[model samples]
Target chain A: MATPVMDKAQATATADYITATFRIRRFNPEESDAVIWEDFQITIDPKERVLDALHKIKWDTDGTLTFRRSCAHGICGSDAMRINGRNRLACKTLIKDINPDKPITVEPIKGLTVLKDLVVDMEPFFQAFRDVMPFLVTEGNEPTRERLQSAEDRERFDDTTKCILCAACTSSCPVFWNDGQYFGPAAIVNAHRFIFDSRDEAGEQRLEILNDKDGVWRCRTTFNCTDACPRGIEVTKAIQEVKRALITRRF
Target chain B: MSTDTSGAIDGVTLYDVDNPAPVIEPPRKRTKKTPKGGGTNFEMIAWLFMRLSGIVLVVLVIGHLLIQLVLDGGVSKIGFAFVAGRWASPWWQTWDLVMLWLAMLHGANGLRTVINDYAERDNTRFWLKMLLYTATVFTILLGTLVIFTFDPNIS
Candidate 1:
């Protein structure tokens, strides 16, 4: 049980600063039939995020390195993209956290049309969101005061309220990719929010809406949407809850 | 942004570029009752069937292989006599009968899921599932009949 001797590690001042390569998928509909990867070499700070590196590349090296972001923090959900083979918020994923040894792969989320380097046409995703009737629906006159709900009732559908409509969960779905008609996970999550809400009178109406051919039945529960969600929502469980609600006629 | 003049969207009046929020639409009403007998819970049952049958199949299939491939000289000991001897016992007969039915149904339903996921056209999906169901039924009937009417004394 003798103590093992440790070798002296090399001392380098630039240890915190590593040279990272970014491989980005580029496509323009009129230009090419397929996508091509463009690589950019950058020296990045360990604490900096992948979004910051993207901004650096776009700002310094290439002006055309296009992507979307609003509140550089994770709240806006505008910066959702594929980073290193997984869907996540670019602003939330640290460059060093993803292993800086190899080239980091950044691309637009799948199951959507890429308008440029990393920006996708979110019209279809939004349309799916819209089709689910995401807003609260009431049958009668508006209440004078706020519609009161119990703490337990509020907790029922609270998990689904984390949806920022990032489209990360929807685009990462195989069913959405194979058959775009399916309402996808985001729509179902939104429906679950209202379907379980105690104050919402139109729960049955929303449930009836979700009872379409492309509605709750189409979700195969592949867990892709659950895995891809940046919000850490239990997407598959919500879908199953909605399904049980459809059968039991109660939430 | 300019009204999507193509009318690709059904209910939206037009696209507003200035306020690009997605236009929310009402959910479509259920056009017809969920067919006649097989009510709305048919898909739910099918999903449940897959999981339940999968768990049972793992036991039945692994036990089947263990006896047929690993017990007392394995496949070499298997022949018409071995099968006839095993079928002689009512327990084995029931075990095999249940296994045949469950396997055929489970495999058929799994392929049905695959076809639903991949088949692009309605006709393609329907016809493919029809072919699968036909094969599964034929195999189940033939296997069940053989298991029941097996003659132990035949040459």
Candidate 2:
């Protein structure tokens, strides 16, 4: 790993800069029917994220090179892409984290149509997210005050609330690659967030929606989502919990 | 995706062409707790059964191999008399019977997952699974018969 950039002096140390090659897959819908991998060499701080290298390419070498990014930090979830054949956020993966010597291969996340270089058609991803009703539902009138919640109640579904809807976990899945109809992992993670919420009254409806063949049943217990999640959500365990809830009829 | 207007031999024509409007069907919703016709989706049960059977098989298969291939004087001590002797006891008969059934079902279920994952064509998948079920049933039935109907007095 690159020496952790602790203080200012180490952060910009000239000696820490190294030359790395970025081999990026380029696709132009307007131009060619085929895609091509273009390579560019650049010198960068080893501690910098892969997004920094893409910025350099876009600014200096090829202005036509395209990608998506807003918050350079990891929280935005806008920069999720395939780096070195794995789904990861471009902003979180450092140059040193993924073999700085070997040409860093950057491509869009799989199982989605590439609208541009790194921009995938996120309609399906968002569609699945919307179908899960990633919101709290209650049958009764609104609570008079800020709805009272104990710490224990808050902790039940806490782990699943970290989902950023990045689609990294979903697109990395082999099952999703095979069948797009399957509600991918991010949708399930979002569902698990609300389903286990002690205050949510509509948990049963969400569970019923997931009980369909293309729903939670298609998961197949693959741990790829757990591995691919940049937010460190226990995706597979959450899926199993949903399955158990379905089998036992207990939300 | 017959979204393009072209003959089999002709190249696809871009949007300057006429094609049928795409069909958009919402995802098929399921209301039944079980699959339609009030039967369980046996595949889900089979998946759960795989793990349970796997644990049992590890014990049954290893213990069987130890007694037959290692514990006695090896394979040399096993012959027709050894076979007849083991089947004479009801316990050994039941052990072999359980082993036979579990191994057959477990292997068949595992192959079913493989077929679901790899078989691309609908007809090919159906026929291949039929063949697998046929062989599995044949072997299981024959093995069950041999275990229960052994003469033991045969030369």
Candidate 3:
């Protein structure tokens, strides 16, 4: 059996801080046309989140470091960046979860124009969302009380309702990265949310929109969107469901 | 202190209200050619066809591989005589013909999707698909003809 001294020392070592290097892709149009990689070495606890490290860099090291983040606990869907070549929310990823022994690489999400260091032009992503008519549609007179639905009907689209409009899934899609015209996985996932709702009467219209050449058909079912979604939504399955709905509508 | 009213900091021109950058349209935005809320369901049908034909091709292709490569004498048994014997039967002729058609169409549709995904330019996509369709048609027709017009006795 080991002595108590070793146990106390082990506990102290467990709480000890280690130095981590963050390699971030920085692009400032005012500074230069080329994107530059800057490394920041910080002494941090392993249990600290990546977002905390970023804040430390911005606050302590460089005041010009820019990144979009809100509701730092993964609710706002912001702060989604390419962490180690994979799309992940900085707030949700811990420093030690990823191999911090090597320099951690961070960049803006792909398939969108990088406006600054980590911010991307999101107008295109939102435009696709609007084109799908994501809101519920009803033609009849408003019910005096409320629109009632069965438990099963509500459960049908429950999986897709969790979308926070984060561009993580859309940016990770290879098809979208190659061709921006393709309505990405996030747009299809949003359409799935409305198309399957039993109360929504605009399923046919949404189906028609998705049946276009650049809509749900563009999805090759690569499952990258599913893997990139920070909210844990099965985005590829939702796209497949929309494709199925389109087919069954015809038959 | 001199104020920089020219919207240029040092030497680079600042893109501000005074010197605005050219507007860039959002990708895939609707236009005159893009009709709203109405389009054909050809892609949906094509997608469904791929799935259905894929299931059928698994049986057809595996059965074909087994017969041609793994049965009785394996590859050694396969020659002009074996092909002639198989083609002599109407059932075998029909089987080969269906397999040819399904495999070609399935492969063509899959390539069409690949071309659509990778080829960014319009003319490139059109020409590539045209080439694909031309090849697909020629192969399908030649295969059908060979299966139908095959003669058992050839000099």
Measured by lDDT, the strongest candidate is 3
Docking verdict class for candidate 1: incorrect
Classified by CAPRI criteria, candidate 2 counts as incorrect
Task: Give one digit per residue, the lDDT tens place, for model 3 in A1-251.
Answer: 97556777778875778899999998766554456689999999889999999999999999899999999999898899999999999999999999899999999998787878998888778878888999989997998998999999999999999998878999999998877777798889999999999999999988888888888987888899999999999998999888878777678
Model 3 deviation from native, Cα RMSD in Å: 6.2
TM-score of each: 0.78, 0.82, 0.88
Error of 3 at B132 (Å): 1.0
Against the true structure, candidate 2 reaches a TM-score of: 0.82
Model 2, span B2-102: residue lDDT tens: 55222222554232224332222222211222132223345456656887999999999999999999995987899889999999999999999999999
lDDT of 1 by residue, A1-251 (tens): 99765543334435768789999887544333345688999998867999999999999999977899999898889999999899999999998789978989999987776676688877667777776778888878888999998999999999999998888898888888777667789989998998999988788877777776677887887899999998999999999999888878742
State the lDDT of candidate 2 residue by residue for A1-251, as single tens digits: 78865688775688889999999988665444346689999999889999999998899999989898888888888999999999999999999999989999999998777777788877777877877789889887887888777999999889999988888999898877765666789989899999999888889888877776567777878799999999999999999998888777731
Better of 2 and 3 by TM-score: 3
In model 1, residue pairs whose N, Cα or C atoms come closer than 3 Å (at least 3 residues apart or on different chains), thus clashing, are none
**True-contact fraction for model 3?**
0.25
Residue B96 lDDT in candidate 1: 100
| iRMSD of all candidate structures | 11.3, 7.9, 5.8
In order, the TM-score of chain B in each prediction is 0.75, 0.74, 0.79
TM-score of 1: 0.78
Residue A145 Cα positional deviation in candidate 1, in Å, after optimal superposition: 1.7
lDDT of 2 at A188: 90
